[model samples]
Target: MALFVETGLKPLSANESYLGKKTKSKAYRMYENHLLRVLPDLPLEPKGKMKLTAEVYYSNKLSDLDNALKPFIDCLQKRYLFNDNRIYKLEVEKFIVEKGAETILFRLDPYSQEGDKDYVPHPTDDREHRCPECGHSF
Candidate 1:
């Protein structure tokens, strides 16, 4: 099932820094509070590898795509009692919309690589590959 949240809140970057202290920003705190009131109860506990697809509607086009993932994923991890490490595949897209129309749509699904013929290797996978032309391993 897909979840939709319309909080009129701007996306907060996880990289926000303050005085060399490690902490969540005020925007993130407000976003979390808003999520607590709007998020629905799940019927089952999510386990194993998972896939997350997020569609973020922002008021402007200047926001970086990568900056939006951390805050939202952190909240989902807290709410669902699951580790973000379990997410094997993540897909995020952002759209520019009018102010006050900012929203986020999320879909979480169980995923497994077993018996899949067309699976692409993740960049962080430990396996080494040999260059076909140079005969070098990277």
Candidate 2:
């Protein structure tokens, strides 16, 4: 299924501390509530490994891509009655846009390993590695 959200994505940050207990920031809480209100109901069946692809548009380039997934996935899990552990593949892309134009587009589908391949090595992968004990390249 596909879903689109018009509001800006909020990262799940460690910003709140109440008596040493962590709490979500007010902004994050508001964002979660907004998502719950706007997100459509999801099917309860078809439980299995799933794949999630998300295209995130941010107002600026200051946000880290990894931080945006948890909050959005959490909302999906809570509202859809599905477990996050069922997700076997996740792909996310980020784009920068003008303020107030931030949005997110995502899709969920059953995962298949048919086309999976081994990881490709980076260009620098063959470079000499440093020995942790001596801090010397070997």
Candidate 3:
């Protein structure tokens, strides 16, 4: 069985060309060809700006190994960053695994307010718990 590790990170500043965009989706060719070759079939959003900032999706299977993504991410910081190696923004956007590999869902802020959207029940989740209006849940 395989589990995925998807972290949605926002770009530090105006680093655009580094992250490609076909239309509204960020192109994963760089991600696929380089970082996550083990799972070549990682999913991505359509060509557009990601919800809050730029994001990349990666997948892993092993549970213990699932959390080993930190050092892998450090490679990005060291290799990229044209200036004086300042890590811009690297945070866990969300963490989930697809049992059926069908629909890929994660909470996003289309409007980017502190209290107006989410489906996850965990209290520690950054965003809101309810739909913020409709009050939906997973």
Candidate 4:
């Protein structure tokens, strides 16, 4: 049982107890419930349901979570709540297909040009190299 019930959740049952004692708790709960219903459609919610849940789970109130997502939504260009997960997968697949067989970037030394003594050997495959000769990049 949560601390709410462990502490014995009960109706005050009298006008005086409810009006005086339980008012704040009841108001807070109502506000939290209202926020939960509103947060998902807000501008700050993340780009997918799974991402939204993962990103916003930190807040005890949905309003807080929605507020927290503001910077992320701005950084991510407000690409919230994709209707299809497979579209996301397809984006990944497109990048992989376009960059096929490129030399992995870490294998190349950025400062080194062709004849530098510190130059690293980058392994290349059959793909046409649209990247700089230093390494296969996007």
- Candidate number with greatest TM-score: 1
C-alpha lDDT of residue 58 in model 3: 31
What's the TM-score of every candidate structure?
Answer: 0.68, 0.67, 0.23, 0.16
Deviation in angstroms for 91 in model 3? 3.1
- Candidate 2 lDDT tens digits, 1-138: 334332222444444423576678999899999988998876545677888899999998998887789889998887777898898788899999999998889888877666556323333447666656666664
In angstroms, the error of model 2 at 36 is 0.7
Task: Count clashing residue pairs per candidate.
Answer: 0, 0, 9, 2
Cα lDDT tens digits for candidate 4, 1-138: 222212123445335544454433575556445544544443432332222222232312323433433333332332333332212111000112222342111110112135445434554458553434445342
For model 4, what is the alpha-carbon lDDT of residue 100?
A: 33
- Candidate 3, residues 1-138, lDDT tens digits: the string is 344332334445435545675332243445434544342332333232223232224354434432434334433333432222232222343333565542223222223234434423323446534444555542
Models ranked on TM-score: 1, 2, 3, 4
Model 3, TM vs. native: 0.23
Q: Give the TM-score of candidate 1.
A: 0.68
Q: Look at candidate 1 and give me any clashing residue pairs.
A: none
CA deviation > 4 Å runs, candidate 4: 1-54, 59-63, 78-138
Candidate 1 lDDT over 1-138, as tens digits, reads 334433333455444544466776798899998887788876534568887889999997998887778788888888878898899787788999999998889988887777445465543548766666665665
- Deviation in Å, model 3, residue 14 alpha carbon: 29
